[model samples]
Target: MKQNIYNFFLMKYSREKIALLISGKASFIALFSLIIIFSFLADKFFSLSNLTNILDLSAILLLTSTAMTFILMLGSIDLSVEGIAGLTGVVGALMVKNFSNSNDYGLLSIIICILLGAIFGLLNGIIFTKLKIPSFMTTLGLGAVASGVCILSTRGYPVIITDQTIRGLAHIKLLGGVIPLLFVIAITINLLIWFVSERTILGRHVIAIGGDEAIAKDLGIKINLVKIMVFAISGAIFGLAGMLLVAKLGAGDIRNPYGLLFDSIAAPLIGGIAITGGIGKIPHAAIGAITLTILRNGMVLLGINPYIQQSVVGTIIILTVAITIERKKIGVIK
Candidate 1:
């Protein structure tokens, strides 16, 4: 009887392991399929200039998506990405040499922007935990408040930057001019995050809570603290993204981060991170970011209308969620 039971459990574990492997590989399969299709549809897709542009464009999205991965892993959402990024971009723009301001803090301004993002994220965590607000609602309200502040402070005008040093971040390329410098910076930060997720106790606790909150509580994990820390970290990345946006656009404007919320959320799901959380890795987010970037680049190359492109993203998000959501947890649709 004991041997029979051992064999039975072994069979069950093997089946589950197989399923997980297939699910993990799905994103890579989709990404390669996208590349093949786009290469044929867009003649310039393989050219150095166009490939460099894709890398450049993917940089900001990559940062934001990695941040989003943490929050999503906690079974929470952050809709304030655009708002925080916009606010920091506008602030960073005004702090540096700009047509709209007299300040020129140079590199110091970048630090301040990232710190500001952390503050905003910290506030989100405190409010959500203390007030028992839903993460989505809390982030949404805060994001709107941030956007309002950006618009009100700037009076709807973009702060055009005059700092050439910072602006060079967008123009500089590496690796035979096929990779943007910004992409390198973004990748470095993401590597640090990946380490945190894979190597730290905090990372394990995050996955623990997402997998089973009650069990995590019984395990003596400080769930609230972990959630708060994750939010603050995500916010800092948003802040950095804002600064990068200013560099790339050569200006700070509330409108500059228009599609950020969608792209950040979409990338992880596309990369095969389960919406239900606790079942993804850092590399999944990287794959997702690159895949989404390529998707957008291909759409532009194909001359698709900007409006329709949004619809495609929305469809992808819905489809990805449907496929990856934990069905047992979602017994019925409200």
Candidate 2:
């Protein structure tokens, strides 16, 4: 009887693994299909310039997604990306380089602003873990506070960035257009994140904590500290992303990119990261971010109805998560 039960469980586990493999393979197929559709519909979608445009976008979204994966892996949802990105972008614009005769702040000012974001994340983690508040509510409240700070700091106006060092990212290619320094920076950050997630004692502890917090604590893991570290890492990366956007756009609007949180969620979800946590990879989320940016860029080049883009992306996110999520882990999705 014992042997029969063990055999039955092994077969069930193998079947689930097969399903996961198929879903993981589908995301790549979706990327290829999106590309083919664009080429067939849009004459200029395959141009070299358009390809670079896609890479530029992938740079920012990838950073945001990479940050969120850490939080998601811990079975937590963080809506703080929007406010952190917006505020930090605003702060960096106001304080980095030269800004419309308003002020002249150097890279040191930028560093200070980045550190502030990390502080915000740290506060959030404390509230969520120590206070025993639900992660969702804690992050939502903290995100609002960050947004309020944005309004107060900028006084409801856009700040223009005019520093050559910062603007270098958006313009000027070295090695005669064969390579871009901006892309190098973005890819470097992603690889560093991958290394931490794949090869550190702390990283393994984090995964173990996410797998089962109760068991992890019984095994002598410092659960609170790991959770706090995850949020801090997220905030710091988002600070970098905000700075990148300022360099890219050359201006920081108070209402810029009003809905970054959705993209943050979508990228990881589409990349095969589990919403229920403990099973996603950081590098995989970058793949999803690039795939998403390609879809958006292709649609614009193809002149698909501008309004249709949001709905299409929303639909894709839902479908991808449905196919990729481990249903057994989340028996009751309310």
Candidate 3:
């Protein structure tokens, strides 16, 4: 019995398990370490109000990053998030009782925005799979189109959302105002994605396809269907994030999602998700978003220049990608 227990402990600490542990917790470890450092350095960094602000800001990025995780898991990329988000925000606002429109669709506007996002995503999938377009180029073009649509819808003007109920939802708080309702909603969405990724056959297929698309195709997996569904789901999430952003800001501007594309891409990449694909968790992306939010918030508190902060984030992305990406799998750097 003693020998068996010792052997079990040894196996638990084996190289494979050790590597898995490191890979799984690397982002989390970095997050906590940064928190500690910032707490010691900035006088107000660890305050409850500041922490709540971080969580609130993290909610939007968390939603977008979660969506991106699905596409990344399939060894594909979605550059259309910002554009889709901007389009949905403008459309949703216009449909609701807002400054620019007399129509009052209420909850239906939200549904329509999400559906619009899904449609665009489906189109992306169809173009990529049927037309044989590279995902990067296809998504980039689609993004541009979506941004154009947003601009046309607003005529280069911002639309103020005056619906009290929608704005109230954004301001709602729980746990003595330490947690925003929007953040709670974002967390719930993340949990659902995690469940799907971990428990469903569709999720397994995504990983298998990412691991080896040729083998997955040969094995009778419906590659096009899966890719399309993933993109649609991602687009819907992006739409929801956009709607939430509108509520938070009380306006729908064409430029609302301008900087989100890079942040969404960076979060998953920093969270140990392979750029080559096939290895990552949904929760990892959320943690990465939180880590980034904390970093940015701490920097602001410490009086760091915003441009310098962007440079630091860019540097971190380069370093993390270099270390975490599966270089052995790709024969060529390009």
* Alpha-carbon TM-score of each model against the true structure: 0.93, 0.89, 0.93
Please give the ranking of all candidate structures by lDDT, highest first, separated by commas.
Answer: 1, 3, 2
**Which digits, one per residue and each the tens of the lDDT, describe model 1 over residues 1-334?**
5334333433443433353456569889989999999999999998888888888989999999999988888888999999999999999999999987689999888999999999999999989888999999999999999999999999999999999988988999998787899999888888988899877878877766666666668667788899999999999999999999999999999999998998899998988777776667777788899999999899999999999998998898888787776665555878
In terms of lDDT, which candidate is stronger, 2 or 3? 3
In model 2, which runs have C-alpha deviations exceeding 4 angstroms? 1-20, 99-102, 172-175
* Global lDDT of model 3: 0.84
What would the per-residue lDDT of candidate 3 be over residues 87-118, giving only the tens digit for each residue?
99988888777977688887787788889988
Whole-model lDDT values for every prediction: 0.87, 0.76, 0.84
Clashing pairs in model 3, backbone N/Cα/C closer than 3 A:
none
Write the candidate numbers in order of decreasing TM-score. Answer: 3, 1, 2
Candidate 1: residue pairs that collide: none
Question: So what's the TM-score on candidate 1?
Answer: 0.93
Which of 1 and 2 is the better model by lDDT?
A: 1
